[model samples]
Target: MDFARLTGLIAATYTPLNERAQLKTDVVPAMVDHLIQQGLRGLYVCGSTGEGMSLSSADRKAVTESYVQAAAGRVPVIVQVGHNSLDEARELAAHAAQCGAEMISATCPSYFKVTSVDALVDSMQVIASGAPELPFYYYHIPALTGSAIDMPEFLQLAGKRIPNLVGIKYTAPTLFEFQMCQSVDGGRFDIVWGCDEMLLGAYATGAQAGIGSTYNVAPALYRNLVDAIEQQKWDEARRLQLVSIEMIRTIGRYPFHPAMRCVLGFQGFDVGDCLLPQPKLSEQQAEQLRSDLQSIGFFDWAL
Candidate 1:
């Protein structure tokens, strides 16, 4: 996809909220600015980290509009509107286009069996139909999608079948799918590494950029990592990678959303806590996280 040619520090942003868990739309602009100032190349708004599943349809649109408007064409903003509900996804895609997002993305429908390659292709086609002019990349996250698309099936229609189908945010640990994507028209399709911990490895495997959850915490460090890779400074990249390795692997297995909520709280944003089906980090753990961050010298001033 032709999405700003964005290739570094694409923050998977958080949707800030008030104490009521209502959409606190105002917090977005400042957050986006903060990341930009910290050296972010792009913003991946309304994604898994943004707690899209925790938002209402209209709220999602508002959040996307708020960020896109705040960005004001300064940088690329990718709106992840992927949801099981086609109606919601379409609404979000249209909202993103109206607000001037560079690209739109969606996860395949899940929670029920959506078997067959035809189903995946058809669903993606429907998503692409929402904003035909802008490119749409399929979000490959089988664990969250509750469905899987074999590599052959995914590569077959990434471009030939769907004209605007540009690239993919391949999220799982399996590099095999990404390798297949590289094999099948690497020029047309931009493959982004979605796993945070394996970013350095993915970068070596032709993952031009990465969309990740932890960028909000330390964007500069990631920017440094990317730069180090470009400069062939493997040691620097490994050091920063070590700093963020914990959360990338363990977030999904634990009460991560709430932990991120706590981190944001410490960062001075009133993003509040995670809703039901997501657990909050323990007060002790949260405090220790802050302490550990201080020890690592991350966000000392709490912007």
Candidate 2:
């Protein structure tokens, strides 16, 4: 199937929660509306930013359904259904298909660690089989997944094995490797760039699209960056990229995702806190984070 390449910024969305940190899906519609208004091109749900691994399978499905229903076909929604268990991942992929998601992506099982390109292909094959009709993009984040199987080789092998294989959510900083992946099969795949801080580099290296956590709060900044790149405004593009780097650095002072959720709260989302293992910001920390963000002029240009 010929899938239209995903372009522009796709927000790896935050899963809204109430005070109890339970699934507060009632906010999904408002969140979706806000994202669309902010100029994000698509929605990527239940990925690392959404705390997919921490949530129960039931919660993941609920989140998927809420986002899909709220989106109402305004934009494409790509569901990330990666799990440690291949069987559960397959089930999640099928559920995403039934829920009307436009695409599916998954990470290789991280616990046991996939050591070979062939094994990586086989693991993805099991997950891709469940949603054979949806386009599959391998979610490659080696820093988190610990499976740094050579992507160009995996794409080469998996292209023949997985019928719905489309591309990759390439997250690492290796631009050379990313370029090689793009060249595979004469550039047939839709390789969406995943690192937010390095977007300018990716665009210069031929990235048509990007998916990232930071896009949720700062869509306009990235849109401007992409616009500047396309218009050959080299100075403006570099400045914009530096702004993003600074923004990420400020957020990195705390547990990154929780601090991001705090930023979301500042934008009036009521997204609550991240799950237990990820850590949450204290009131003092939240205050400090807000001050830090302000110091960087985040409120001026972030929207």
Candidate 3:
């Protein structure tokens, strides 16, 4: 296991698509350059923001390949391989390791959800074993998974069963459980905060890193947020956190995925639309979104 600590803003990137919502692997290089320019610490590919669950396994593999290729050792790439099927998740995990992804992460199986901590640990162990060489982080986003098992307990059980388990993408709102997870085994795990809107609260609990969709659009704001909090500049950190919360709330008025894609389009990526069932913004809506963001000074705060 590589055990290298993942810190700072790890952007949960959007999967670039063509007008037909096909994977536009070609756009990844430009996307990489755009993020690097924003000073992101790492990339979290094929996760919630990337619409990983909506994509076919082949498409996920292709996106992972494109990101690893484009990053070209510039930054660490953590690939999310969680799927409803353990075999499919294992397959993707294997492919991620083969392609040189720095780490692999997975959320609970949602369709036939694992309701018990032991069951969740069993599920995670199988997935982690597939990529034994790479560091593995269990993605704990109960809001989406509905697993709702106690995370602190999950970590205690998972730590013993899965040797490669290094940390978690701690996405739940329960900060008390989050604090317990962080303090497990004398702060043994690297708990990266996943809720973008309430990041300051997480930072106060000793969260050194975060992963979020908003980081894709405004890396400077979050990078500065991290700096401000670290420097004990509470006033500045609070202000930045409010701006982030407002920006997310504004874009979230529409279907969040599509609106964020539109925001990226505004950033010059032309990453295209979110896949169907996720909804696509009309050109008029997209224009209005851009105008609204501008009115709120998103561009000014954005990198």
Best candidate, lDDT? 2
Off by over 4 Å in 3: none
lDDT of 3: 0.91
Task: Summing lDDT over every window of 10 consecutive residues in candidate 1, give the lowest-scoring window.
Answer: 246-255
Q: What is the lDDT of residue 156 in candidate 1?
A: 77
What are the Cα lDDT values of the candidates? 0.77, 0.95, 0.91
- Per-candidate TM-score against the hidden true structure: 0.91, 0.99, 0.98
lDDT of 2 by residue, 237-260 (tens): 999999999999999999999999
Which is the better candidate, 2 or 3, if ranked by lDDT?
2
**Candidate 1, residue 174: how far the Cα is off, in Å:** 1.2
Writing each residue's lDDT as its tens digit, candidate 3 over 1-303 gives 448788788889999899788998999999988888788889999999999999999999999999999999999999999999999999999999999999999987999878899999999999998899889999999889988998888888888989999999999888888888999988888889999998999989888888999999999998889899999999999999999989999998889989999999898888998887888899899999998898889999898
Candidate 2 residue runs with Cα over 4 Å from true position: none
Kindly list the per-residue Cα lDDT of model 1 for residues 1-303, writing each as its tens digit.
Answer: 344455776888888777677888888888888888887778888788888877888888888888888888887888988777887788788888887998888887776656877788888887878888887878888788667768556767656667778778888898877767866754556777888888888888878789887877756667777888899999888977876685444433446777777776777666777766666677787877666666655664223
* RMSD, candidate 2, Å: 0.6
Native-to-model Cα distance after best TM-score fit, residue 285 in candidate 2, in Å = 0.4
